[model samples]
Target: MKRRSLLKLGLGGAVLLGLVGGGMALLKPGLVDKHMSPSARELMRAVALSVMDGLWPAPGAARDAALQAHLDRVDANIGGYPAAVRAELSQLFALLSSSGGRLALIGMSQDWPKASVAEIQELLNELRLSSLDLRQQIYHALRDLNTIAFFTAPEHWASTGYPGPREIP
Candidate 1:
């Protein structure tokens, strides 16, 4: 194919993919809002485990509770974001929740719940180091969300040695 044709084809494919993803997000209105759908929650839980690693609690009730709290904080944080930012995050979450997206973006064929932390970590590392700007952006977004959620709680501040914000008179 001619260079012009090749570029056109690629651009067309990208547009189509974006439209489909946007449609999916629209179909599940809750998915695009501050409230995370079940699938988005699961995806983020896996991402939190992988990204937080040592900071995350061990595999037990404490870990489960901590993860839930982190997710709740993430939801609250997203709620405070501008509409456009929320829309973009919703699209990213929708894409990652799909099977094809899981494989293509993170190279994980299995569902998030079943994937091991090691596996998820490897995939996340790939995204972090990927030459593709989109993948790196995804990595940063996930990592930042998890990090912010985990550390914002006063309970977790001890780990980072962040003394509670100085008492303002």
Candidate 2:
């Protein structure tokens, strides 16, 4: 009787372990795990990092100009993003502008090599805050894509087949 009871207890424990392991497998990221390939995840990370790179402090005009050039290249390649994503990007862009303004203001207070230490420090602080704020905005935008159902349906408009954008005339 004692041996039978012990065997039953061991079996129950194994079953419980199996159930928990299966549950954890199911709990893991479903869509991201199955849908987003490695390349896609890397691309998303690159986009976020590009935004972060823009917010970094640039001391010299040459470095600043180079950063601007890189940004233009990325802009041309990325093209027009979706409307919802664009709105969030715009918010981050505004923060970048604010950081740039601080840099210019601090530049004004001191000479090329020797500037107001306090203003420079303040500019760095502002840039850090701006970067953090932008990170949050980007996260919110990506997280939203997981849940928001943007398109409920679809339609097609063609010439002669339906009333298209061109007009009847």
Candidate 3:
């Protein structure tokens, strides 16, 4: 083929490759997993610890692992919701993750992970008592999701006086 035709073909191939690469990148999950964004996941970690304070394992590897398990369950539960609901949750999580949002909503200037249990409890209490309906809803949603995930485990059932499902003989 002539030099011009060869050059044209090469450029076309490059363009096609670029387009395909960009498409794949867009489709890839990036920072957000199937159900939660990175910030959202981070926020949930702190929230879980706070909401399950007395119930949470003592600070150690076991506690870390338990927190992750609960977060995974929470993620799975969030995945079951419709797209719109998921989007709203994502937005809420992201907002809470930000410094400004944390201060405004939770009244905490420190990072979520660093915030003490008392601080978190206070923020949650404030949220629950807030005159704003949205704040109250946010508090309930976070508390309920964490509780549901924590109690879903069989071990937690014992604490609640719930025996494992009984099979009919």
Candidate 4:
């Protein structure tokens, strides 16, 4: 096939995939206007485990509670965003929730819950350094959200060596 034909084929395939992904998101409006859905929570948990690796306590009840708390904070933070931003996030969550989106976008063939922290970290690094603007943007959004949620809690400040804000004179 001619180079031009191949380019067109690739572009057409991307568009088709985008359309299918959008349709799937619309079909499942979990994260659209509401609080974090189960899938979204799971996605964020996986991301948090990867991004906040050493920050988390050892694998036990405390770690589990901390993870849950982080998710709650993330949900709260997302809730405060404007509707348009929330809608965009909803679409992003929906896309990642789908297997095709996970593979095509993040190169992760497994479901979020099943994916290991190392796998997630590798995908996140790839996203961070990817040539594609969309992938990089996704990485930033996920990283920013997780970091913001984890850091904003006063209880976590000690871990970061950020003594609570100095008292007013």
Candidate 5:
């Protein structure tokens, strides 16, 4: 084993490993272990926009910040769930990330972000009324997460006529 031969072998091994890792990542995008992947986050962001469309009327940066904050809250909540629950949610997110699953579940050939608010509403209604338990469950999960995240924020308290707490220090 000369020095040049050893260097070439090491580089070859690294390249091979990189190729394998990349291939595995492409084949099993659902293998996210700890937190939601970027694709899942994007999907959820689109869902949040559709689900919480009318809740916040602010335009420009205000609306963007609110949506991003809601997503952060939702992500934190999901991170705190038990492993089994997280795994289920991850699987669902992965399925929805795929084109086939999106078409089947959402009944739309277009991307989630590109789907109009009306299209999203229609799909949501279908899911809500679906005979399949999983579809209904997914709808409830997304709806509940979005609603809870939006309403529970302190900034939105005025909308609910909730005055600040009376116990001033």
Candidate 6:
């Protein structure tokens, strides 16, 4: 009876573990890892704003001023940004830098919209995926910075050396 009871308990625990694992897997079937950081967030915003301007050129000077303001905010202090901070920013810039310039070219071209419905859809899908891919890289890089900070706050802060990362926080 004692042996039988132990076996039953062991099996029940295994079943419970399996059920918990399966539930979590089903709950987030397509989970993608992500992180958030100030620099990454700012850089992503800059890229997104650029992309927006590309798709719809701000319509006037006020909008252009706002966009430049945003870009300046992100670019400030970037030369000495921490490695983790730098990595995330660089990854985001790469995505947009490579393809962002030509967005207006494709969008305004007659060949794209005039293509067959399927082709047009494909083009749109490609654009969507590329944007998503860039966003994801930004997210991961930002998240990585956050995680590094959590465990190793001082590693990257030394970039500023004596005055490393503002003490306000």
Which predicted model would earn the best lDDT? Answer: 4
Q: Which ten residues in a row have the lowest lDDT in candidate 2?
A: 147-156
For model 2, the local distance difference test gives 0.38
Question: Candidate 1 lDDT, tens digit per residue, 12-102?
Answer: 9888877877776676543544778889999889999988789877779998899889999999998998888888888788878887666
Which runs of model 1 end up more than 4 angstroms from their true locations?
A: 1-5, 29-33
Q: List the global CA lDDT of all models.
A: 0.84, 0.38, 0.76, 0.89, 0.75, 0.41
lDDT of 4 by residue, 49-142 (tens): 9999999999999999999989989999999999988988888888888888777777778899998999899989999999999999999999
Tell me how far the alpha carbon of residue 107 in candidate 4 is from the true structure, in angstroms, after superposition.
Answer: 1.6
Listed in order, each prediction's TM-score against the native is 0.87, 0.23, 0.76, 0.94, 0.74, 0.29
lDDT per residue (tens digit) for residues 1-169 in model 5:
9999999998997677556544444565543655668777777777778887777767789888887888788777787889888777766776677776666555668877787878888888899999999789989987887778777889878887988678978
Residues 16-67, model 2: lDDT tens digits: 7456434433343112212332333332333333334443346587655544
What clash pairs does model 3 have? none
By TM-score, the candidates rank as: 4, 1, 3, 5, 6, 2
Candidate 3: worst 10 consecutive residues by lDDT? 22-31
41, model 1: CA deviation in Å? 0.5
Output the better candidate (1/6) by lDDT.
Answer: 1
Summarize candidate 3's per-residue lDDT along 3-54 as a digit string, tens digits.
Answer: 9999999999767755654443344321255577666777788888888888
* Best candidate (score: TM-score): 4
| Clashing residue pairs found in predicted model 6 | 35-143
Candidate 3, residue 124: Cα displacement in angstroms equals: 0.3
1 or 5, greater by TM-score:
1
What's the CA error at residue 105 for candidate 4, in Å? 1.4
Query: How many pairs of residues collide in each model?
Result: 0, 0, 0, 0, 0, 1
Better of 3 and 4 by lDDT: 4
C-alpha root-mean-square deviation, each candidate: 2.1, 21.2, 14.2, 1.3, 13.0, 17.9
